[model samples]
Target: MGLFDGYNIASSGMGAQRTRINIVSANIANAKTTHTEAGGPYKKQNVVFEELLVNNTKNLNNNLQETNNKNTSAELRGVGVKSIVENDADPIMKYEPSHPDANEEGYVAYPNINPVVEMVDLIEAMRSYEANVATFNTHKNIDSKTLEILKA
Candidate 1:
Protein backbone atom coordinates (compact mmCIF):
# COMPACT_ATOMS: atom_id res chain seq x y z
CA MET A 1 0.00 0.00 0.00
CA GLY A 2 1.16 3.54 -0.74
CA LEU A 3 0.96 6.62 1.46
CA PHE A 4 -1.86 8.11 -0.58
CA ASP A 5 -3.83 4.89 -0.57
CA GLY A 6 -5.35 5.85 2.77
CA TYR A 7 -6.72 9.07 1.30
CA ASN A 8 -8.14 7.23 -1.71
CA ILE A 9 -9.84 4.61 0.43
CA ALA A 10 -11.23 7.16 2.87
CA SER A 11 -12.60 9.34 0.10
CA SER A 12 -14.33 6.36 -1.44
CA GLY A 13 -15.90 5.45 1.89
CA MET A 14 -17.02 9.04 2.31
CA GLY A 15 -18.65 9.04 -1.09
CA ALA A 16 -20.48 5.80 -0.42
CA GLN A 17 -21.66 7.02 2.98
CA ARG A 18 -22.77 10.31 1.48
CA THR A 19 -24.88 8.42 -1.05
CA ARG A 20 -26.40 6.38 1.76
CA ILE A 21 -27.25 9.56 3.66
CA ASN A 22 -28.90 11.05 0.60
CA ILE A 23 -31.04 7.97 0.01
CA VAL A 24 -32.07 7.83 3.66
CA SER A 25 -32.99 11.49 3.62
CA ALA A 26 -35.09 11.00 0.53
CA ASN A 27 -36.85 8.03 2.05
CA ILE A 28 -37.64 9.97 5.22
CA ALA A 29 -38.82 12.99 3.28
CA ASN A 30 -41.27 10.92 1.26
CA ALA A 31 -42.41 8.62 4.02
CA LYS A 32 -45.86 10.18 4.24
CA THR A 33 -46.15 10.78 0.52
CA THR A 34 -49.21 8.86 -0.67
CA HIS A 35 -49.18 9.97 -4.27
CA THR A 36 -46.38 9.72 -6.78
CA GLU A 37 -46.29 9.90 -10.55
CA ALA A 38 -45.12 6.31 -10.58
CA GLY A 39 -48.31 5.30 -8.75
CA GLY A 40 -49.23 4.95 -5.09
CA PRO A 41 -46.72 5.65 -2.31
CA TYR A 42 -43.05 6.55 -2.50
CA LYS A 43 -40.57 3.71 -2.52
CA LYS A 44 -37.60 3.47 -0.18
CA GLN A 45 -34.17 3.79 -1.77
CA ASN A 46 -30.89 2.09 -0.82
CA VAL A 47 -27.32 2.43 -1.99
CA VAL A 48 -25.14 -0.35 -3.36
CA PHE A 49 -21.34 -0.41 -3.09
CA GLU A 50 -18.61 -2.16 -5.03
CA GLU A 51 -14.94 -2.65 -4.38
CA LEU A 52 -12.31 -1.00 -6.55
CA LEU A 53 -8.98 -2.65 -7.35
CA VAL A 54 -5.82 -1.01 -8.64
CA ASN A 55 -3.91 -2.74 -11.46
CA ASN A 56 -0.53 -1.60 -12.80
CA THR A 57 2.57 -3.24 -14.07
CA LYS A 58 5.54 -2.77 -11.71
CA ASN A 59 7.95 -4.05 -14.37
CA LEU A 60 7.34 -2.83 -17.93
CA ASN A 61 9.91 -4.25 -20.38
CA ASN A 62 10.26 -7.77 -19.03
CA ASN A 63 9.05 -11.13 -20.36
CA LEU A 64 5.34 -11.73 -19.92
CA GLN A 65 5.81 -14.53 -17.44
CA GLU A 66 8.52 -12.66 -15.49
CA THR A 67 6.44 -9.48 -15.44
CA ASN A 68 3.39 -11.30 -14.22
CA ASN A 69 5.36 -12.95 -11.45
CA LYS A 70 7.15 -9.74 -10.46
CA ASN A 71 4.12 -7.52 -10.38
CA THR A 72 2.65 -8.34 -6.99
CA SER A 73 1.25 -4.90 -6.24
CA ALA A 74 -2.37 -4.12 -5.53
CA GLU A 75 -4.20 -1.16 -4.03
CA LEU A 76 -7.74 -0.38 -3.02
CA ARG A 77 -8.81 2.57 -5.14
CA GLY A 78 -12.09 3.20 -3.34
CA VAL A 79 -15.73 2.21 -3.19
CA GLY A 80 -18.30 3.15 -5.78
CA VAL A 81 -22.06 3.33 -5.45
CA LYS A 82 -23.51 0.80 -7.85
CA SER A 83 -27.04 2.18 -7.77
CA ILE A 84 -29.83 3.57 -5.70
CA VAL A 85 -32.32 0.73 -5.79
CA GLU A 86 -35.94 1.18 -4.85
CA ASN A 87 -37.59 -1.26 -2.53
CA ASP A 88 -39.99 -3.48 -4.46
CA ALA A 89 -41.78 -4.48 -1.29
CA ASP A 90 -45.38 -3.48 -0.95
CA PRO A 91 -46.28 -0.27 0.87
CA ILE A 92 -48.01 -0.30 4.21
CA MET A 93 -51.72 0.40 4.01
CA LYS A 94 -53.43 2.51 6.62
CA TYR A 95 -57.12 2.82 7.29
CA GLU A 96 -57.60 6.53 6.77
CA PRO A 97 -61.09 6.99 5.51
CA SER A 98 -61.00 10.78 5.75
CA HIS A 99 -57.60 11.10 4.13
CA PRO A 100 -57.56 12.89 0.78
CA ASP A 101 -55.41 10.15 -0.75
CA ALA A 102 -57.58 7.35 0.49
CA ASN A 103 -58.69 4.78 -2.03
CA GLU A 104 -62.19 3.61 -2.76
CA GLU A 105 -61.75 0.98 -0.07
CA GLY A 106 -61.15 3.70 2.60
CA TYR A 107 -57.45 2.87 2.87
CA VAL A 108 -54.45 5.12 2.23
CA ALA A 109 -51.11 4.00 0.94
CA TYR A 110 -47.91 4.86 2.83
CA PRO A 111 -44.28 4.43 1.94
CA ASN A 112 -42.60 1.25 3.09
CA ILE A 113 -40.02 3.39 4.86
CA ASN A 114 -40.17 2.89 8.59
CA PRO A 115 -39.09 5.78 10.79
CA VAL A 116 -37.04 3.55 13.04
CA VAL A 117 -35.17 2.01 10.16
CA GLU A 118 -34.49 5.35 8.51
CA MET A 119 -33.21 6.83 11.74
CA VAL A 120 -30.90 3.88 12.29
CA ASP A 121 -29.56 4.09 8.79
CA LEU A 122 -28.99 7.81 9.17
CA ILE A 123 -26.99 7.26 12.33
CA GLU A 124 -24.87 4.62 10.68
CA ALA A 125 -24.25 6.84 7.68
CA MET A 126 -23.21 9.75 9.88
CA ARG A 127 -20.83 7.53 11.81
CA SER A 128 -19.30 6.18 8.65
CA TYR A 129 -18.86 9.68 7.31
CA GLU A 130 -17.13 10.71 10.50
CA ALA A 131 -14.84 7.71 10.34
CA ASN A 132 -13.84 8.61 6.82
CA VAL A 133 -13.11 12.19 7.82
CA ALA A 134 -10.95 10.99 10.67
CA THR A 135 -9.08 8.71 8.31
CA PHE A 136 -8.47 11.58 5.93
CA ASN A 137 -7.20 13.76 8.73
CA THR A 138 -4.83 11.02 9.85
CA HIS A 139 -3.42 10.70 6.38
CA LYS A 140 -2.97 14.42 6.11
CA ASN A 141 -1.07 14.46 9.38
CA ILE A 142 1.18 11.66 8.21
CA ASP A 143 1.91 13.50 4.97
CA SER A 144 2.71 16.72 6.83
CA LYS A 145 5.04 14.88 9.19
CA THR A 146 6.84 13.21 6.31
CA LEU A 147 7.39 16.56 4.62
CA GLU A 148 8.74 18.12 7.81
CA ILE A 149 11.13 15.21 8.26
CA LEU A 150 12.32 15.51 4.67
CA LYS A 151 13.15 19.21 5.20
CA ALA A 152 15.30 18.36 8.24
Candidate 2:
Protein backbone atom coordinates (compact mmCIF):
# COMPACT_ATOMS: atom_id res chain seq x y z
CA MET A 1 0.00 0.00 0.00
CA GLY A 2 1.12 3.51 -0.74
CA LEU A 3 1.97 5.87 2.08
CA PHE A 4 -1.29 7.79 1.72
CA ASP A 5 -3.52 4.76 1.22
CA GLY A 6 -4.02 4.39 4.95
CA TYR A 7 -5.11 7.99 5.22
CA ASN A 8 -7.54 7.57 2.34
CA ILE A 9 -9.04 4.44 3.84
CA ALA A 10 -9.34 6.02 7.30
CA SER A 11 -10.90 9.18 5.92
CA SER A 12 -13.44 7.13 3.99
CA GLY A 13 -14.29 5.22 7.13
CA MET A 14 -14.75 8.46 9.05
CA GLY A 15 -17.04 9.83 6.38
CA ALA A 16 -19.19 6.70 6.34
CA GLN A 17 -19.42 6.57 10.12
CA ARG A 18 -20.26 10.26 10.27
CA THR A 19 -23.12 9.64 7.89
CA ARG A 20 -24.31 6.75 10.03
CA ILE A 21 -24.19 8.92 13.15
CA ASN A 22 -26.24 11.59 11.45
CA ILE A 23 -28.86 9.08 10.40
CA VAL A 24 -29.05 7.68 13.90
CA SER A 25 -29.42 11.16 15.33
CA ALA A 26 -32.22 11.94 12.95
CA ASN A 27 -33.97 8.72 13.79
CA ILE A 28 -33.75 9.49 17.51
CA ALA A 29 -34.93 13.05 17.01
CA ASN A 30 -37.99 11.96 15.09
CA ALA A 31 -38.85 8.94 17.13
CA LYS A 32 -42.10 10.43 18.39
CA THR A 33 -42.91 12.31 15.23
CA THR A 34 -46.53 11.61 14.36
CA HIS A 35 -46.58 13.05 10.87
CA THR A 36 -44.40 14.30 8.10
CA GLU A 37 -44.82 16.10 4.79
CA ALA A 38 -44.91 12.68 3.20
CA GLY A 39 -48.31 12.12 4.88
CA GLY A 40 -47.27 9.70 7.56
CA PRO A 41 -45.13 9.30 10.63
CA TYR A 42 -41.45 10.01 10.23
CA LYS A 43 -39.66 6.92 8.93
CA LYS A 44 -36.40 5.96 10.56
CA GLN A 45 -33.45 6.40 8.23
CA ASN A 46 -30.37 4.20 7.80
CA VAL A 47 -27.06 4.66 6.08
CA VAL A 48 -25.95 2.06 3.57
CA PHE A 49 -22.21 1.63 3.19
CA GLU A 50 -20.44 0.32 0.10
CA GLU A 51 -16.88 -0.26 -1.00
CA LEU A 52 -15.25 2.49 -3.01
CA LEU A 53 -13.23 0.82 -5.76
CA VAL A 54 -10.06 2.00 -7.40
CA ASN A 55 -10.58 3.01 -11.03
CA ASN A 56 -7.47 1.24 -12.33
CA THR A 57 -8.36 -1.99 -14.12
CA LYS A 58 -5.18 -3.72 -13.05
CA ASN A 59 -5.72 -2.87 -9.42
CA LEU A 60 -9.33 -3.94 -9.65
CA ASN A 61 -8.42 -7.30 -11.17
CA ASN A 62 -5.68 -7.86 -8.66
CA ASN A 63 -7.97 -7.02 -5.80
CA LEU A 64 -10.56 -9.45 -7.11
CA GLN A 65 -7.96 -12.21 -7.54
CA GLU A 66 -6.60 -11.57 -4.08
CA THR A 67 -10.09 -11.87 -2.65
CA ASN A 68 -10.61 -15.14 -4.50
CA ASN A 69 -7.33 -16.41 -3.12
CA LYS A 70 -8.24 -15.30 0.41
CA ASN A 71 -5.24 -13.01 0.57
CA THR A 72 -5.07 -10.17 3.08
CA SER A 73 -2.60 -8.12 1.06
CA ALA A 74 -5.29 -6.65 -1.16
CA GLU A 75 -5.65 -3.09 0.02
CA LEU A 76 -9.20 -1.83 -0.19
CA ARG A 77 -9.75 1.44 -2.01
CA GLY A 78 -12.08 3.00 0.55
CA VAL A 79 -15.60 3.12 1.88
CA GLY A 80 -18.59 5.17 0.81
CA VAL A 81 -22.15 5.78 1.77
CA LYS A 82 -24.16 4.04 -0.93
CA SER A 83 -27.50 5.43 0.15
CA ILE A 84 -29.67 6.67 3.01
CA VAL A 85 -32.78 4.58 3.07
CA GLU A 86 -35.97 4.99 5.07
CA ASN A 87 -36.86 2.07 7.25
CA ASP A 88 -39.70 -0.06 5.94
CA ALA A 89 -40.67 -1.24 9.37
CA ASP A 90 -44.19 -0.47 10.40
CA PRO A 91 -44.76 2.52 12.61
CA ILE A 92 -45.51 1.95 16.30
CA MET A 93 -49.07 2.72 17.23
CA LYS A 94 -49.93 4.02 20.65
CA TYR A 95 -53.32 4.66 22.16
CA GLU A 96 -53.59 8.39 22.59
CA PRO A 97 -57.21 9.34 22.41
CA SER A 98 -56.73 13.05 22.97
CA HIS A 99 -53.62 13.43 20.85
CA PRO A 100 -53.99 15.73 17.87
CA ASP A 101 -52.56 13.22 15.38
CA ALA A 102 -54.56 10.26 16.63
CA ASN A 103 -56.60 8.28 14.17
CA GLU A 104 -60.32 7.67 14.53
CA GLU A 105 -59.46 4.58 16.52
CA GLY A 106 -57.63 6.77 19.02
CA TYR A 107 -54.25 5.44 18.00
CA VAL A 108 -51.32 7.66 17.12
CA ALA A 109 -48.69 6.34 14.78
CA TYR A 110 -45.17 7.07 15.96
CA PRO A 111 -42.02 6.60 14.01
CA ASN A 112 -40.68 3.06 14.06
CA ILE A 113 -37.61 4.03 16.05
CA ASN A 114 -36.41 2.86 19.41
CA PRO A 115 -34.38 5.33 21.38
CA VAL A 116 -32.19 2.65 22.95
CA VAL A 117 -31.47 1.08 19.61
CA GLU A 118 -30.70 4.44 18.04
CA MET A 119 -28.47 5.32 20.95
CA VAL A 120 -26.56 2.08 20.51
CA ASP A 121 -26.15 2.74 16.81
CA LEU A 122 -25.00 6.27 17.53
CA ILE A 123 -22.38 5.02 19.97
CA GLU A 124 -21.13 2.44 17.51
CA ALA A 125 -20.85 5.02 14.74
CA MET A 126 -19.07 7.43 17.05
CA ARG A 127 -16.57 4.78 18.13
CA SER A 128 -15.93 3.82 14.53
CA TYR A 129 -15.40 7.44 13.60
CA GLU A 130 -12.99 7.86 16.51
CA ALA A 131 -11.07 4.78 15.44
CA ASN A 132 -10.78 6.15 11.92
CA VAL A 133 -9.55 9.45 13.26
CA ALA A 134 -6.95 7.64 15.34
CA THR A 135 -5.85 5.70 12.28
CA PHE A 136 -5.54 8.91 10.24
CA ASN A 137 -3.52 10.59 12.99
CA THR A 138 -1.24 7.58 13.26
CA HIS A 139 -0.60 7.69 9.53
CA LYS A 140 0.14 11.39 9.68
CA ASN A 141 2.62 10.83 12.50
CA ILE A 142 4.33 8.05 10.57
CA ASP A 143 4.57 10.21 7.48
CA SER A 144 6.03 13.04 9.50
CA LYS A 145 8.62 10.72 11.06
CA THR A 146 9.55 9.37 7.63
CA LEU A 147 10.05 12.93 6.36
CA GLU A 148 12.23 13.73 9.39
CA ILE A 149 14.33 10.63 8.82
CA LEU A 150 14.78 11.48 5.17
CA LYS A 151 15.85 15.02 6.08
CA ALA A 152 18.47 13.72 8.54
Candidate 3:
Protein backbone atom coordinates (compact mmCIF):
# COMPACT_ATOMS: atom_id res chain seq x y z
CA MET A 1 0.00 0.00 0.00
CA GLY A 2 1.15 3.55 -0.73
CA LEU A 3 1.35 6.37 1.80
CA PHE A 4 -1.80 7.98 0.39
CA ASP A 5 -3.88 4.83 0.16
CA GLY A 6 -5.99 5.85 3.13
CA TYR A 7 -6.95 9.08 1.42
CA ASN A 8 -7.77 7.31 -1.83
CA ILE A 9 -9.98 4.77 -0.09
CA ALA A 10 -11.93 7.46 1.73
CA SER A 11 -12.24 9.59 -1.41
CA SER A 12 -13.57 6.72 -3.45
CA GLY A 13 -16.20 6.01 -0.81
CA MET A 14 -17.23 9.63 -0.74
CA GLY A 15 -17.54 9.79 -4.52
CA ALA A 16 -19.71 6.68 -4.60
CA GLN A 17 -21.94 7.97 -1.82
CA ARG A 18 -22.31 11.32 -3.53
CA THR A 19 -23.43 9.69 -6.72
CA ARG A 20 -25.92 7.59 -4.77
CA ILE A 21 -27.33 10.67 -3.11
CA ASN A 22 -27.77 12.41 -6.46
CA ILE A 23 -29.55 9.41 -7.92
CA VAL A 24 -31.86 9.09 -4.96
CA SER A 25 -32.69 12.77 -5.19
CA ALA A 26 -33.59 12.38 -8.82
CA ASN A 27 -35.78 9.40 -7.99
CA ILE A 28 -37.59 11.48 -5.42
CA ALA A 29 -38.04 14.35 -7.83
CA ASN A 30 -39.53 12.11 -10.47
CA ALA A 31 -41.65 10.09 -8.12
CA LYS A 32 -44.83 11.55 -9.56
CA THR A 33 -43.81 11.50 -13.15
CA THR A 34 -46.10 9.21 -15.12
CA HIS A 35 -44.45 9.69 -18.47
CA THR A 36 -41.00 10.33 -19.79
CA GLU A 37 -39.09 10.34 -23.07
CA ALA A 38 -38.82 6.59 -22.62
CA GLY A 39 -42.62 6.45 -22.86
CA GLY A 40 -43.22 5.25 -19.36
CA PRO A 41 -43.29 6.26 -15.75
CA TYR A 42 -39.97 7.29 -14.28
CA LYS A 43 -38.12 4.30 -13.00
CA LYS A 44 -36.23 4.56 -9.74
CA GLN A 45 -32.48 4.53 -10.20
CA ASN A 46 -30.31 2.45 -7.89
CA VAL A 47 -26.57 2.59 -7.42
CA VAL A 48 -24.64 -0.64 -7.21
CA PHE A 49 -21.29 -0.47 -5.44
CA GLU A 50 -18.22 -2.64 -5.82
CA GLU A 51 -14.90 -2.84 -4.06
CA LEU A 52 -11.91 -1.46 -5.91
CA LEU A 53 -8.63 -3.29 -5.55
CA VAL A 54 -5.88 -1.83 -7.66
CA ASN A 55 -3.03 -4.01 -8.92
CA ASN A 56 -2.49 -7.26 -10.78
CA THR A 57 -4.61 -10.34 -10.13
CA LYS A 58 -1.69 -12.04 -8.43
CA ASN A 59 -2.22 -9.75 -5.45
CA LEU A 60 -5.91 -10.64 -5.05
CA ASN A 61 -5.53 -13.39 -2.42
CA ASN A 62 -3.02 -11.32 -0.51
CA ASN A 63 -5.41 -8.43 -0.32
CA LEU A 64 -8.33 -10.48 1.01
CA GLN A 65 -6.22 -12.27 3.61
CA GLU A 66 -5.49 -10.95 7.07
CA THR A 67 -1.99 -9.56 7.10
CA ASN A 68 0.25 -10.38 10.07
CA ASN A 69 3.15 -9.49 7.83
CA LYS A 70 3.46 -5.71 7.77
CA ASN A 71 5.67 -5.79 4.67
CA THR A 72 3.00 -7.53 2.59
CA SER A 73 2.20 -5.59 -0.57
CA ALA A 74 -1.57 -6.03 -0.12
CA GLU A 75 -3.14 -2.88 -1.47
CA LEU A 76 -5.71 -0.68 0.21
CA ARG A 77 -9.11 -1.18 -1.35
CA GLY A 78 -11.82 1.39 -2.17
CA VAL A 79 -15.48 1.51 -3.09
CA GLY A 80 -16.71 2.20 -6.60
CA VAL A 81 -20.02 2.39 -8.41
CA LYS A 82 -20.42 -0.77 -10.45
CA SER A 83 -23.60 0.38 -12.15
CA ILE A 84 -26.76 2.44 -11.88
CA VAL A 85 -29.86 0.41 -12.64
CA GLU A 86 -33.49 1.26 -13.06
CA ASN A 87 -35.98 -0.45 -10.81
CA ASP A 88 -38.36 -2.75 -12.68
CA ALA A 89 -41.18 -2.61 -10.17
CA ASP A 90 -44.50 -2.05 -11.85
CA PRO A 91 -45.85 1.49 -11.94
CA ILE A 92 -48.45 2.50 -9.39
CA MET A 93 -51.91 2.78 -10.82
CA LYS A 94 -54.55 5.27 -9.69
CA TYR A 95 -58.06 5.76 -10.94
CA GLU A 96 -58.37 9.03 -12.85
CA PRO A 97 -60.76 8.66 -15.72
CA SER A 98 -60.26 12.23 -17.04
CA HIS A 99 -56.47 12.27 -16.71
CA PRO A 100 -54.71 12.64 -20.03
CA ASP A 101 -52.46 9.65 -19.44
CA ALA A 102 -55.20 7.43 -18.08
CA ASN A 103 -55.44 3.95 -19.50
CA GLU A 104 -58.55 2.46 -21.10
CA GLU A 105 -59.41 1.14 -17.66
CA GLY A 106 -59.55 4.76 -16.33
CA TYR A 107 -56.38 4.33 -14.31
CA VAL A 108 -53.30 6.57 -14.44
CA ALA A 109 -49.87 5.07 -14.08
CA TYR A 110 -47.43 6.75 -11.70
CA PRO A 111 -43.75 6.18 -11.13
CA ASN A 112 -43.00 3.26 -8.86
CA ILE A 113 -40.93 5.48 -6.60
CA ASN A 114 -41.92 6.01 -2.99
CA PRO A 115 -40.81 9.32 -1.51
CA VAL A 116 -40.34 7.86 1.97
CA VAL A 117 -38.02 5.16 0.71
CA GLU A 118 -36.09 7.65 -1.38
CA MET A 119 -35.69 9.94 1.62
CA VAL A 120 -34.40 7.09 3.72
CA ASP A 121 -31.91 6.17 1.01
CA LEU A 122 -30.84 9.80 0.78
CA ILE A 123 -30.17 9.93 4.50
CA GLU A 124 -28.15 6.74 4.36
CA ALA A 125 -26.03 8.00 1.49
CA MET A 126 -25.43 11.31 3.30
CA ARG A 127 -24.32 9.44 6.38
CA SER A 128 -21.95 7.28 4.36
CA TYR A 129 -20.49 10.37 2.70
CA GLU A 130 -20.02 11.99 6.09
CA ALA A 131 -18.25 8.90 7.37
CA ASN A 132 -15.86 8.93 4.43
CA VAL A 133 -15.15 12.60 5.00
CA ALA A 134 -14.38 11.87 8.64
CA THR A 135 -12.05 9.07 7.58
CA PHE A 136 -10.24 11.34 5.10
CA ASN A 137 -9.86 14.05 7.73
CA THR A 138 -8.43 11.53 10.18
CA HIS A 139 -5.87 10.41 7.61
CA LYS A 140 -4.92 14.01 6.93
CA ASN A 141 -4.45 14.66 10.61
CA ILE A 142 -2.29 11.57 11.02
CA ASP A 143 -0.12 12.60 8.07
CA SER A 144 0.26 16.07 9.54
CA LYS A 145 1.32 14.67 12.91
CA THR A 146 3.79 12.33 11.23
CA LEU A 147 5.40 15.29 9.45
CA GLU A 148 5.61 17.22 12.73
CA ILE A 149 7.22 14.26 14.47
CA LEU A 150 9.78 13.95 11.68
CA LYS A 151 10.60 17.67 11.94
CA ALA A 152 11.11 17.30 15.69
- Using TM-score as the measure, the top candidate is 3
- Assess candidate 2 and give its TM-score to the true structure: 0.85
lDDT of each: 0.83, 0.85, 0.85
Q: Give stretches of model 3 more than 4 Å off.
A: 55-73
Clashing pairs in 2: none
Model 2, residue 124: C-alpha shift (Å) = 0.5
In lDDT terms, how accurate is model 3?
0.85
Q: Give candidates' CA RMSD values in order.
A: 5.7, 3.4, 3.8
- Which candidate number has the best lDDT? 3
For model 2 the local lDDT of residue 51 reads 75
lDDT, candidate 2, 16-45, per-residue tens: 998899889989988888989988899999
**Cα distance off (Å), candidate 2, residue 76:** 3.2
Stretches of candidate 2 off by over 4 Å are 54-75
Q: Candidate 2 vs candidate 3: which has greater TM-score?
A: 3
Q: What residue runs in model 1 are displaced by over 4 Å at the alpha carbon?
A: 54-72
Model 3 lDDT tens row, 1-152:
57888988899899999999999999999989988998978889999987777433333345455444677755567788889999889999999999888999999999888799889999999999999999999999999999999999
Residue 1 CA displacement from its true place in model 1, Å: 3.4
